[model samples]
Target chain A: MIILNILFAIAWMALNNAYTPVDFVAGLLFGFLVIIVSRRVLTREPLSLQSWFTFSARRNYPLLVWRWAAFIVFGFWSIVKANIVMARIVLSPQLRLQPGIIAIPLDITSEIGITILSNLITLTPGTVALDVSSDRKTLYLHAMDARDPDALRRETKQEFERRVMELLP
Target chain B: MSLLEIVTLALTALGVLFIFLSSVGLIRLPDVYTRVHASGKSATLGVVGVLLGVAVYYVDLRVALEMLALIVFFFITAPVAAHMLDRAAYLTGVKPVAGTAPDDLEGAYNRETRSLR
Candidate 1:
């Protein structure tokens, strides 16, 4: 499937007589259409989208694209917010902190889902995703401050994991 | 000079500031784990900010897309690298800073047997 897409992208570039990045992107866009049409004619089963386009169980590309954008923006904003807090901690003279590890239960099951969630958690300031349990049911995270564990967990779930679940599911 | 240029310059400065903050945390933080927390998040976000500035300055679709792709790649990889490092540090039994209560994984692994229970 991937090889076919690559071939279509190459074909698009050749037909257009341009090899620039713009042409590559244009080729990819064209390749999507070519693959969509050819797959239906060649095989009875639908060919799943790959690479930039996510493959979901429902095969809804449009919705996936929208959610993916939202996820990126949210993730970026979360990073900004985390950084501000972390900077405050670093600059403060007192260095008052209650750092500790706590188990954050997992809601996303797939390996990709778990990976994405863990990575985002680590990327967000003040939180580091330590490890996943043997059964993959819980994620252990280290926080810069866990004076209020419930609030920390709540924010993580609401801001990071919730969006990740939406993106992957 | 223009609104877009002003925005680009601001983002670039913010990005540099975050990168600087990461270093500050690295120096002041007590432990290796905490240092990772400082370096990982700020560095990734810092680079992303700089890339955004570049993308904005270019103001072309292809350049913007390429920059976006770079941001995405950095975002995805940085955390994974940090997670691996953190796990390796933990399994090797690097202790946290003093005054931290209740080491949860203390019982989860056997340092003598070198195996996780």
Candidate 2:
């Protein structure tokens, strides 16, 4: 497992085009830093092989390839949609915005799953993830044009949560 | 100015303007909750604009790829941090904007008849 982690770290650095001698030193330093930090930060439970595999495989091979393909298509579409929405808001005469925060219930229990969902929401233009409940059961999102909060919840649940569940395990 | 120079300058100016607005909004917004909105959203867009301008100026694969990575990392982390801050505020009973309408969370909680049914 440690070897796998090191190899993954090396691959990540290489992918970032950080392969010089100095970069190699920096990567080693970063690996050491991650270990030190994880020792302190990861106290809830020791990660098992299953968990590690789950985390690694999501990046390598998703369980639901079709869902991932859809996500890639949808993700690009969302980016275009976001740019349009942002332009409209910035250029609008009245700037008639109704911003509100809504709480979304999360079904996925894995930390990685939740983290991915939060990042996905943040990357999208119209919404931002405001918080996660301490119990990790609910996520708070602030939407720029929250016409109906229920619709926002359903949108999140359907668009992100369902795909995440399919991808994670 | 040449077209390339003009484009570069325009993008750089807009990027800097966004950064400035984000900083000002961070200060001018009413509360921490609102400030998060200003800083997180505006700054991400601001940095992306700056990076895009840099990519255009450099026009090299390595620099452009690095800029892309930076944008992706920024987009991923900014909202997660904001979410943490907002949740902390809410749990501490920070006052929300007054006279807001349609709190379904409250309605649902009130409608529940049994705690363990």
The per-candidate count of clashes, in order, stands at 0, 2
lDDT of 2 by residue, A8-74 (tens): 5686688778776556556655665565445323433355645544444434332344467787677
Instruction: Please give the range of 10 consecutive residues that has the lowest summed lDDT in model 2 chain B.
Output: B108-117
Docking class of 1: medium
Global lDDT of each model? 0.79, 0.65
Query: What is the per-residue lDDT of model 1 for residues B38-94, given as tens digits with 9 covering 90 to 100?
Result: 888888878988999999999898899899899889888888877888778888879
Runs in model 2 lying further than 4 Å from the true structure: A1-80, A83-97, B1-7, B17-35, B103-117
Q: List candidate 1 stretches off by more than 4 Å.
A: A1-61, B1-8, B57-62, B110-117
Query: Candidate 2 lDDT, tens digit per residue, B38-78?
Result: 66666666777888888888777779889989977877777
Error of 2 at A47 (Å): 34
Show pairs that collide, candidate 2: A130-B83, A131-B83
Report how far off residue A15 is in candidate 1 (Å).
11
Model 2 chain A weakest 10-residue run by lDDT: A56-65
